[model samples]
Target: MATLLVLGFSSGLPFYLTSKTLQAWMTTAKVDLATIGFFSLVTLPYSLKFVWAPLMDRYTPPFLGRRRGWVLITQVLLLLVIAAMSLHDPRTGLKMLAVNAIAIAFFSASQDISLDAYRTDVLETREMGAGAAVFVMGYRIAMITTGALAFFLADRTSWNNVYLLIALLMIIGIAATFVAAEPVLNDAPPKSLAEAVVLPFADFFQRAGVLRALVVLLFIVAYKYSDSLAGSMTTPFLLQAGFSQSEVGAVFLGVGVIATIAGVVVAGAAIGKIGINRSLWIFVVFQGLSNLTYYGLSLSGKNHGFMVSAVITENFGLGLVTGAMTAYLMSMCNKRFTATQFALLSSLMAASRDILVAPAGKIIEGVGWPGFFLITVAMAIPPLILLPFIAPWSSDVPIGAAPHTGETIPARRPQPPLAVRR
Candidate 1:
C-alpha cells in the first residue's frame, strides 16, 4: 500500500506540471489563451498510452525485474525532463516548452502503464479495494501539491524555482523504486512483440467470449458516465449559482478533500466485507444520486450550508465509486497481459470522462442546471440495469472469480462462460 501510494504520487506529479503548471507559467509570461489552450494537446499521450502498452508487456528491463525496471527508468526520465523545463523561458522558448511538456507527458503516461501493471500484478484479490484507495489518495495529494501548492510557491519565488523543487520531489519515487519488491509472476512475459500485441486482445475475447466481452466494455464506459457528465459542469454551476471562487476553492480543499478521502477509506473497508459487486450497487447509487445536491443548490441559490453539503456529498460519493470501479477493473485483467489489458480498460474508462462528456454543454443548454443534474441522475440507471447481467447481486467473487490469484503458468484462468443463465 505504501509503495502504491508513492507510485501514485509519482504518476500524478508530472501530469499537472506539464499541463496545468505549464499553462500558469505561460500565462504569467504574457502568453495568449489560444496558445495555452493548444498546449493542452501535450496530454494526448495519456489517452493513447494503450497503443504502446504491449511493448512493456513483451520486454522486461534489465534491472529491478520487469515492472520495477520500467518504473525506475521512467521516473529518472521524468525528473530530468521536468527539471529541464526550468531552463526554458516560456515567451522565447514556447516551442521548446511544448516539446519538454510533451516529453513529460510521454514519460508520465509510460510510468502509469508500468506502475498500474505492477500494482495489479502484486496485489492480492482481497487487497484490491484498499490498494486502489490509498493509490488514489496519493494521486490526489500530488495533484494538490502541483496545482495549489505550486502556485503558492510561485507567489513566493520564481516559477523556475518551483519546477526545480518539484523535480527534486521525484527522488521520493526513485527511493521507493529501489526498496520496492518486484512481483513474482508464474508465467514468463510474451516472447515476441507480435505475441504481446495479438494475445492480450485474443485472450480477453476468448476468455469472456465475444458477446460478454462487448458487454463488459460497455459496462466500463457506462458505469461512470453520469459522474463524468455532471463533473464537467460542476465548477460552472457553482460559479453561476453565485458562489465566489474563493468560497468554492475553500470548500473543495477543505470539505472536498476530507470527504473524498474518507469515502475511499470507508468504501475500501466495506468492499472487503460486502464484496465488489455489492459495493458497486451501493456506491454507484450514491454516486448518481449525489448529483441531486447540485439540483437542490440550483433551486436554493447561494446558501453556504447547501454548498458545503453539496461538495461533501458529491466528492465523498465520487471517492466510493472510484474505489469500487478500480477494483472491478483490476479484477478483469489477466496476469500475463496485465499491462496491455489494464491500459485498454483504463483508456476506455478515460474515454467516458474525456469523450462522452463533450456533449454536456449542449445538453445543459437545453436542460438548464437543475434539469441537467436530473438528467445526470437518470444517466446512472443503465449501468445499474447492467449489474444483474455483468456483476449479479448474489455473487461475492468477481465475474471471473478472483483474478490474478493462485494460478500457475500452465493453468488456464477460469472465465465467465459464454451464456448468461437467468
Candidate 2:
C-alpha cells in the first residue's frame, strides 16, 4: 500500500502541471481560451499509451526488471522535462510549453503503465480492490496537491517555481523504483514483439463474450462522459458564477479538495464492507445525482451558500465514484496486458471528452447554464442504464477475465475457443 501510494505520486504529480496548470499560466499571460484549450489536447499520449506499452511488457528494463526499470527511466526523463518546462515562458513560448507538456505526458503515461503492471503483479485477486483504493487515494492526493496546491501557489509564487517544486517531488518515485521489489511472473516474456503487442488484445477479445464484451466496452467508454462534459465546463462555470478569483480558490481548497479526500476514504471503507460491484452501483447513482446538485446551484442565482454546498456535494461524490470506478477498472483488466489493456480501457473511458469536451463552453452558450447542466446530467443515462449488465460484476465470468464471450486473436490461430480474460 505504501509503495502504491508513493508510486501514485511519482506518476500523477506532473500530469496536471503540464495540463490544466499550464493552461492557467497561459490564461494569465493573456493567451486566448482556444489556445489554452489546445494545450489540453496534449494529454492524448495518455489515451494512446497502448501504442508503446508492449515494449515495456515484452522485455525487462536493465536496472529493475519488467516494471520498476521502466518506471525509473520515465521518472528520470519526467524530472528533466519538467525542469525544462520551467525555462519556457507561457506568454512568449506557449509552443515550447506545448511540446514540453507532450514530453511530460509521454513519461507520465509510461509511468502509469509501469504502475499498472506492478499493481497487478504485486497484489492478489482478493486484495486488488483494497490496493486500488489505496493507490487511488494516493493518486488523488497527488492530483489535489498538484491541481489545488499549484492553483494556490500560482496566486503567490511564479508558475516556474511551482513547476520546479513539482519536478523535485518526482524524485520520490525514482527512489521508490529502486527500493520496491518487482514480482516474478513465471509466464515467459513475449516470444516476439508482435506477440507481445498483439496477444493481449487477442486474449481479451477471444476470452470475453461478444455481447458482454461490448457491454464492458460501452461501460468503460460512457461511464465518464457526463462527468467529462461537466468538468470541461467547471472552471468557466465557476468563473462566470461571479465569485471573486480568490474566493474560487478558497472554495476549491476548502470545500472541493477536502470533501473529495473524505469521500475517497469513505468509499474505500464501503468497498471493503460491501464489495466492489455493489459499491459501484451506489457510486454511479451518487455521481449522477450529485451532478444534479450543480443544476440547483445554477438556478439558485449563483448564491454563495448554495455554491459552497454544491461544490462539497459534487466533489465528495466525485471522489467516491472515482475511487470505486478505478478499482472496478483494475478488476476488469487482464494482468498480462496490464499496460496496453488498461491504456485502451482508460482511453475508451477518456477519449470522447478528451477530444470533444472542449465544445462545452459553446454548448452552454447555445442552451444557457440551466439547460446545459440538465443536458450534462442526461448524458449519464447511457452508462447508468448499462450498469445492470455490468453488476454482480458479470456473474458469469470468472476472476481475471470477462465472461461468456469469445473473439479472435490475430497472431496465433484462426479459430480460437472463447475464453473469459480478466
Candidate 3:
C-alpha cells in the first residue's frame, strides 16, 4: 500500500500540473482567458489514452517489469516536460507550453495504465476494493499537494521552483517501482501479441448490448460532469468571494484536504461493512448532493466561511463516492482485458470531466453562478440514471452474482515464476 501510494502520485501529479495548476500559471502570466481555455485541450491525451493502452499491454519495457517500465518511462518524460514547461513563458511561448502539456498528459495517462494494472493484479479479489481505497487516498493527496500546494507555491515562489520540486518528487515513484513485487495474473498469458491485442477488443464487443457499451460510456462521462465543470470556475469564484490567496489555500487545500482524506478512509470502511452495491447507490446520491455545497456558497454571497464549508463538504463526499466507484469499475473489468477495458472506461470517465467541463467558463460567464451550478446538478442526473444499467452489467462477474471479489481464489499456477523473464 505504501508503494501504491507513491506510485499514485506519479499518476496524479501530472494531472494538476497540466490542468488547473497550469491555468493558475497562465493567469499570472497575463494570458487571455480564451488562450488559457485552449490549454485545456492539452488534456486530450487523457481522454484518448486508450489509444496507447494496447501498446503497453503488448510490449514490456526493457528495464522495469512490464507495468513498471511504462511507469518509469512516463515518469522520466513527465519530469522533462514539466521542467521544460517551467522554462517557458505562457504569454510568449504559449504554443510551446501547449506542446509540453500534451507530453505530460500523454505520460500521465500511460503511467495510469500501468499502475492501475499493477494495483489490480497485486491485490487479492476481495482486497481490490481496499486497494482502490488506499490508492485513491494517495491520488487525492497528490492532487492536494500538486493541485493546491503547487498553486500556493507558485504564488510565493517562482513557477520554476514549483515545477522543479514536483519533478524531483517523482523519484518516489521510481524507487517504489524498483522495490515493489510484480502482481499475479488470474488468467493465462497470450502466446502471441495478436492474442494480447485482439482479445480485449473482441471481449468488449461480444458482451451483452451495443447500447449498453454506449450507455456505460455515457455514465463514465456524465458521472463526473458536475464536479469537473464546476471546478474550472472555482479559483475565479474564490477570488470574487473576496478571500485572500492564503485563505483560499488554507481552506480548500488545507481543511478541504483533511476532510477529503477522512471521507476516503470512512468510505473504504463503509465498502467493507456494506457490499459495493449499497455503497455505490449511497455514494452516488451523496455525490450529486455534494454539489449543493457550491450552490450554497454561491447563494450565500460568497462568504469565506461558506466557501470553506462548501469545499470541505464536497471533497468529503467525493472521497467517499470515488473510492467505491473505482472498486465497482474494477469489478466490471475482465481480467483478460484489464488494461484496455479499464483504460477505455477510465478515459471515457475522464472525457466526461475534461470534455464536458471545459465549457464551464463560458457557462458561468453566460448564466451567472447560481444558474451554472444548477446546470452542474443537472449534469449529475445522467450518471445516477445510468448507474443502475451499468451496475448490473459485469464484464468480470456475472449479472446476478457479485464479483469474485474476495480471496486470492487460488491460482492454478503460482504467478509466473519471477525468475524467468519473457
Measured by lDDT, the strongest candidate is: 1
Q: Candidate 3 — what's its lDDT? A: 0.73
Number of the top-ranking candidate, with TM-score as the measure:
1
Model 2 TM-score is 0.83
Decide which is better by TM-score, 2 or 3: 2
- Relative to the true structure, how large is the alpha-carbon lDDT of every model? 0.87, 0.75, 0.73
| After superposition, candidate 2 runs with Cα above 4 Å error | 23-41, 86-98, 147-162, 356-367, 393-422
**Which scores higher on lDDT, 2 or 3?**
2
Clashing pairs in 3: 125-405, 126-405, 126-406
lDDT of 2 by residue, 126-227 (tens): 455566767776787888889878988889988888888889998888877777766656557677889888887777766666677778787877776777
Task: Score every model by TM-score.
Answer: 0.94, 0.83, 0.78
- For candidate 1, the 10 contiguous residues with the lowest summed lDDT are 405-414
lDDT of 3 by residue, 8-95 (tens): 7667878888888888888988998988887788877777777777777777678655666777787887777778776887768877
TM-score of 1: 0.94
> Which segments of model 3 are wrong by more than 4 Å?
19-40, 62-64, 80-101, 147-162, 189-198, 205-214, 226-249, 295-302, 357-384, 392-422
The candidate, 1 or 3, that scores higher on lDDT is 1
lDDT of 1 by residue, 1-422 (tens): 78789988988888888787888899999999999999999999999999999988998988887888899999999999999988999889889889989999999999999988888887877778888888888888899899999999999999999999999999999988887777778877799999999998898888777888888899999998988999899899899888899998899988898898888888888887888899989998999999999899998898999999998999999899899988888888887888999999998889889999998999888988899999999988999988887788898755653356622221133586799779
